[model samples]
Target: MEDIPNYVAATFIAIVIAVLGFIYYAVNTATPGKKNLTSSLVVTILVGWIFFVCVQTFNGYFTNLSGIPRLPMFVGLTIVSIIILFIWPRTRAILMEMPITTLHYIHIVRVPVEMVLWWLAVSRAIPMDMTFEGSNLDIISGISAPFAAVFMVGSRSKSRIGATIWNLIALALLYNIVKTAIGYMPYYFTPTGGEVANLGVFYFPYVLLPTFIVPAVLFSHLVSLYQLIFKKDQPQF
Candidate 1:
């Protein structure tokens, strides 16, 4: 981790902020009447989660490979929270009504995220497989996000189907990188790169990837999918 340049970490932190800002914007836009309450709630919850994860990481909770793995547990809680938000009527409505452009454009952050991953890989903080040079093809999704937003910006049936397909493909890419990351954790699986154990993620800044960035990206896809498949009329840009 020490070998990683300061710029990489700075870039990553910027990405995290960008993601959080986008989420706040999306929530605020979706629920205009309750924008203040909902936006504040979203920011508070996300900021609190990030702080908690940082404290845990500083305490060596996630780094301690001895007992049950804390990293997976932490990620599981996030997943469950997302599921609840999707199923809860009020929150679900916000998600369903969020602008499709918001969902699509937010993914642009993934481009810099992938670059940060590549930098980490170069520093040997993580395995190469987690970057574009290896198995993680998620950068493609980031690159195409703007075009996807423009291409699907109407109520056309074909556009909706096309957008749905793009979302699924992007979701699968996300899953692939996440799975690859888990396989390199020191809890159960052996490190993919002999000595590198994907431990950077258990540290500050990087911890934000699992707790905030990934979840935000995942939720965006889910919201977009729900809007495309279930909502009768798609929101225009």
Candidate 2:
């Protein structure tokens, strides 16, 4: 629940995507048979996203976490990437299972989704001021939609649903950002303290909704994984 810059959100997501992509590209491009492209990309992007979050939080005030540095965190995660891909069994197994199309679709979702969310916040259509209330409904989809992908049934069509939703949200976010940039969008809520209360870094419930998005992703994935393990034939979509 700290003050976060819009650029930080976008840039952090970029960093996450870049790192994840690098790993996927390395493993999938080089290793054969084991690689599943979509999951690899999602993992790669999520790892990079951690860096984005770290920097955003450490750089901000009011949290009293100022002593912590940003670059070091990124460095650590970088090492983590190496270890995860090269040494960790769980990591290796997950990466090997990733599909090429899924990887492609994940990147498609995260980057634009973050951008779309920020654009809405900036436009004041969403509560850019970082309060827990008065957020735009469009902003909600930006977080929740890509999140649904995390819980996919691992069917071939999984990527399709995520990608379509991402595109729709991204376009909406783009439109919102443009509207804000033109000075027409309304800013309904501005926190007096400039603090995004109760939300995690670069996060706001009304604006970001971690509980909604993150939980949805986890629960969805868990259920999907369960079905896959239990011999159910749920379609990926």
Candidate 3:
């Protein structure tokens, strides 16, 4: 096995920190009083990520480990993110209050994220199926986000219908990539057996995908949907 380089890991770690920092800034706008909790959330997520890296890479628990239906770490992180966005009272409220336009901008992270995945694929760290050329069409969502943010969100045009449709489409794209990723894992329930094992995801930086970015991006899509549907604050140009 090729030893992972420090620069690759360091660059990804920096991206993760930047993404979380942006999230904190965006979220703080809505829940000013939750500063302590927000800070704690950042700390907790970083700590959790460090622990996951240590376990999977340093401790060697996930090296060639197989037979599990799903990576428990991935599933656990996704589940916790769902609960935080949908079930937690204060957190849910803050998410709901977030400006729909900002939600659209947040998804721009997916663009760089997709590029990073492609780089990993080029390095043979992950499968090509997870990249733009394959089944993962999630980059479409990222590319279209800014346009949607401008036309649908900023203008507050009479295009609520268009906005709603865009969100649904982006959400579906996200779901597709997530489903494909899970199915390609090295597990008993995996849909296929091939040379490509999703071993890259278990390492540092990439682990942040399941732990931080995907969940956060997923939550962003969900909350945007909630705001579009439940709340009637659609801005009009």
Highest TM-score against the true fold, candidate: 1
Residue clash pairs of candidate 1? none
Q: Number of the top candidate by lDDT? A: 1
Candidate 3 local lDDT, residue 43: 54
Give the per-residue Cα lDDT of candidate 3 at 39: 53
| lDDT, each prediction | 0.86, 0.41, 0.73
Clashes of each: 0, 18, 1
Worst 10 residues of 1 by lDDT: 152-161
Model 1 stretches astray by more than 4 angstroms: 154-158, 191-195, 235-237
Candidate 3: 10-residue stretch with minimal lDDT = 186-195
User: Model 2, range 126-175, lDDT digits (tens) per residue?
Assistant: 44532212233334443554344454323434544554455455446434
35-131: candidate 3 lDDT, tens digit per residue:
5677567557656765765566556565546555335565576667677668877667777777678788888778878877787777777789899
The regions of model 2 sitting more than 4 angstroms off are: 1-62, 70-82, 111-114, 120-237
Residue 211, model 3, lDDT? 63
Model 1 earns a TM-score of 0.94
